[model samples]
Target: MNSNNDVIRKLHELTEADMSEAEFLQSVENNMIPMQQFFTYYRCAIMEIETKFRVLNEQFSLNGESNPIEFIQSRIKSYGSIFRKIMTNHIPRNVEAIERDINDIAGIRVVCSFVQDIYRLADCFLRQDDITLIEKKDYINNPKPNGYRSLHLIVAVPIFLENEKRLVKAEVQLRTIAMDFWASLEHKLRYKKDLPPYQLNLLADDLKKCADQSAEWDRRMQDIKNILESN
Candidate 1:
């Protein structure tokens, strides 16, 4: 694998220096194997993290506590998306560079029942010794200008291969059910290329209002849950 990457690095250097289309294609073909290997490692890391969440949910059930996590979704970035990012970011065309820079190449979305549940689950997950927190963005508290609300965490987990233990990074997005619903709709509508600028602005404003309402709903639901627990 090392020899293959070394060769690929040389090819990448040539490509940077304006290699022909045939040479570029050859470099891509050579990169395919190592790229797939890196993706496999990322998938393994996702499995490890998902299993941890599942265990946490089960423990909550066993202790007569409602499960915090509603559902989990995991995915690897598609080749087209990866290539677009590499070109747009001017990143080195190598597996190592991609693995180091593309933190969201492997992603896991965890939707919870309430706002508090999101934080609770995150704290519990991060407390584990093996899970390394690389970066955190608290969008729930400090939402985006478009009113997006979610806790984004870039975490590293060790995936044991046949002869090596490699640490892989994955982005974990935690949000409440309401927030997720609003985000899903917003995402679907945001990409309507047919919409004119004025219409798009109007749609954005509506989505922002909806996001605020969703956040309020989450707060109310959390308060009710707290009241019930206190009783």
Candidate 2:
């Protein structure tokens, strides 16, 4: 496939061919240039944000840690299916739109010791003139029906590449350590089955209640830590 249209046609042909989904997906992976561009685009997008905001890996990590591009490659390796679906099926609004969605499509969990850090970073990330906030979801304040709590933002950013430029959409998630733990567990359990609407509703209610309690606990622990540090 020379362009996006060719890519689509190739996808259709692959689907029709006498190969399993795994084989079809492997063929797509074998396309060296596009695959390389795909990951490179995502990395550059994140780097742009980091550069714009003066945010280092150390700033986001609780341990003040940093990771190399190889670490990022390892992480994306697990998300191969997500990339495949995007390339073959989800025809983006435009080339720029595709970049924005790809750049903003991933999630970064900011694990803070206190609840306030979540709000603080969200404010900092959203206030940037370069980063356009399309939507804000305060799940920590009004969480999902599941006991999930995280600050979510849908943001649009314009990326100027050498050959072309485009606006991309990204999803940002901010939450506390406790809330993050709950969310990770909740995602694992919920995706285990095809739950009915009523069951989903029940799970959501339980999650909300749990998130509320977790936030309360975070506040209390933060207060105690601050008091000890002060003394």
Candidate 3:
């Protein structure tokens, strides 16, 4: 069996030399253990972040406050997707480089009940001493060109191992329930390759209109909640 460093070095060589996909797969097959271990660290980091949000939700319940979080979803990027990213972006071909450049190896999506809850949960998560904020993109305030909206955060959290503690990066996306619903449908429709160009354009326009309406709904719901709280 190759040592971890040896496996990393071999993989780096294979990627850097632009080996055939079959050759790369053979190398990966021979050295699956180390690669799997690398991704496992990211999984641990996701668990740590998820636990923090779960605890916060539980605290709100205990205090008779409305739970802000509706649901939490987490995923680790597949190896094939990671490889495509490395090749597409001309990233450095090494384990260290991949870890450094890929911010979303592990991801957590937190769906909140209201727009306000998105920022509230983000603030609470970032305020913790153990979590380090690496980057933040407020797409909710400034929607993307396609009218997508979400609060994206790239954070580093320490994951404890039996022998060492590793700080891994994971992306946290906070969005309102309506926003999530809109995004889910948009993603599904946008990926259909069979759609004609004209139809695609029309679909895109409709999606943008829907996004605007959903955002307005979120605002009105939040206002009603504020009124009730004031009573």
Candidate 4:
């Protein structure tokens, strides 16, 4: 279930005299259905991973331990976004190049209650024999230049097709609730193109402060949880 309303609206905005609006709309409608269907595998991969996390949460609950994971989110990149990425990166416009060059086409975000939980679930997830760890970037341990903090993992998981199994890559971002807050705000600010450089730098510095404070809070909260559990 995808909406072509956005595509149709965008195309109308860019309408030119030479192009037939009726023909162009029909062409877009024709093209969008297949593109939407092509990403079905990615969605399946997301569902598989989401299910794994949910199962893990339930197990922890059964054991009388706290469930670290708060919620999960998944997304498959839109065709327009993929096209822009290909153009920006100069990647060949083909299925092979798209898979080879774009690892974040399919993404999942896991928000946890504590910093320790982030590492704990990630370790457990990657330790599974079926999930192949392709790459990892620990921004939580080493914050990004813009003061963004999250653990990013690129893993290849097998998607069982009707004919065969296809391994697809999905980028997972694991972060604490505090980190998610800062990141959400940072992302909102980042897309505000009209902001002047000085203001942007100030915002970046402020975000750094917030990130540090959040990290400290994570440490103290985890310590408190540890103390309470020891009783």
Candidate 5:
């Protein structure tokens, strides 16, 4: 029985037409157990990655000079058509060893002081031999036509437990405080259309300029904090 009510209903109907009552019940139990495990394992993996990022971020903060970071990892709900495709088609095929192999299983966002630091910290994070670099996009250096800027990387890592070793992939984002603020605001009001394209383009250009200015301010702020700490 799939945890999903709809799937269980459909499975019951399908089995009613073909299998004996006891056999159908046994099949449901067997199949649902592994399916449930697939989700549970991925959730555990995401939590582990989040905890690692938290430890790293706290270590960086101890210097009182590094910008903050946040991490989030979550399971995509099994209600949408996307999940339908994933479960019925993808999972059935066992095309990938894990369901997280398809979705955004793990995510981390690092907020740095300056544009330069974004790349610096990203390089530092990727330097871990345990992490296998899969893909990268330096959006900060090469902003999208929409003037969005950030660094994106996908990394594959091998997680070992007492019982087994599993390969997990995580997406990491790096951006400055200004860039993150702008992105957050944009996301909040994404449905607005009153702003003309030309105005939006001009706004993006202005925000890019602001991002640069904020980077300078961040450096100055860090310097001021350091000087005070020394005193």
Candidate 6:
């Protein structure tokens, strides 16, 4: 079997799964290079946002205030995921359409120390002149049906290429460590394709319970933090 990076490389080299070697090579020549360039902006955007978060961290440290941000994770969506989304959305299956329609080619997940930190960091992050807030979804205030909790932001960041500056939209998910922990597990469970119906139902219920417990923990931690800050 091929390694993970090897598998991804193959898919990029071969745009559609149905293509043979000759077609794959031609498609690669036609589509892959431009797609690669587009993703470069995503990489730059991730770096730009990551740097902004690091600046926040540094400022908090100098103030002797506990940092709101615990850590950050960023990724460019896999070619397969992008392709599938294109097909599912009934949009043109080309790099241009994907670039024009897909807002989450890049993703950033910010894990914070407390629930309040999620809000505080998001507010500060958007205050920067370079970050244009496109959309905001407060899942913590209105948890998902399965008890998922997070603050989702769709922000456009400017990326400068050789001769042009372009704005790219990236999805940012801000949540407490507890919420992140729960989400990671929930994702794994939900994607377990082999799970039987009864087993999946039980797992779903259990995951919801775990989410509630994690949320309560976040609340208690925030309260303790408020007490300490008050003293």
The candidate scoring highest on lDDT is: 3
lDDT of 4 by residue, 54-143 (tens): 988898899898888998988877655565565557777656677788998899999999888889899989998889999999998898
- What TM-score goes with each of the models? 0.86, 0.59, 0.86, 0.83, 0.58, 0.85
Q: Residue 143 deviation, candidate 6, in Å?
A: 1.0
Which ranges in model 3 have alpha carbons more than 4 Å from their true place? 1-33
Model 4 ranges with Cα > 4 A deviation: 1-34
In model 5, which regions exceed 4 Å deviation? 1-36, 61-103, 192-231
**TM-score, candidate number 6:** 0.85
Q: Each candidate: what lDDT?
A: 0.83, 0.59, 0.86, 0.79, 0.60, 0.81
Q: Indicate the TM-score of model 1.
A: 0.86
Pairs that collide in candidate 2 are 96-166, 100-168, 100-169, 104-170, 145-204, 146-204, 146-207, 147-207, 147-208
For model 2, the superposed segments whose C-alpha errors exceed 4 Å read: 1-39, 50-104, 194-210, 225-231
Candidate 1 global lDDT: 0.83
Worst 10 residues of 4 by lDDT: 24-33
**Decoy 2 TM-score against native:** 0.59
Model 5 lDDT per residue over 1-231, tens place: 446755744543442254443442343322433544655555665666566566667777887856456433244333232233444544533424334445444566666665556665677667877777888988776776555678888777676767998877766777777778877775654434478778877777776676566556656876886688689
Q: Which ten residues in a row have the lowest lDDT in candidate 1?
A: 21-30
Q: Give lDDT tens digits, candidate 3, residues 65-162.
A: 99999999999876555676776577766677788899998999999999888998899899999999999999999999888999999999999999
Q: Estimate candidate 3's alpha-carbon lDDT, on a 0 to 1 scale.
A: 0.86
- For residues 1-231, write the lDDT of model 2, one tens digit per residue: 298755655544443343543443454433433545665655565666545434633465545532211121112322334444456566443434444445445444455656666676667677777788888889877866656777877777667889987555556666677887787777666543467779988877787787778878988987987798689
What's the CA RMSD for each of the models?
8.5, 9.0, 8.2, 7.2, 10.1, 6.0
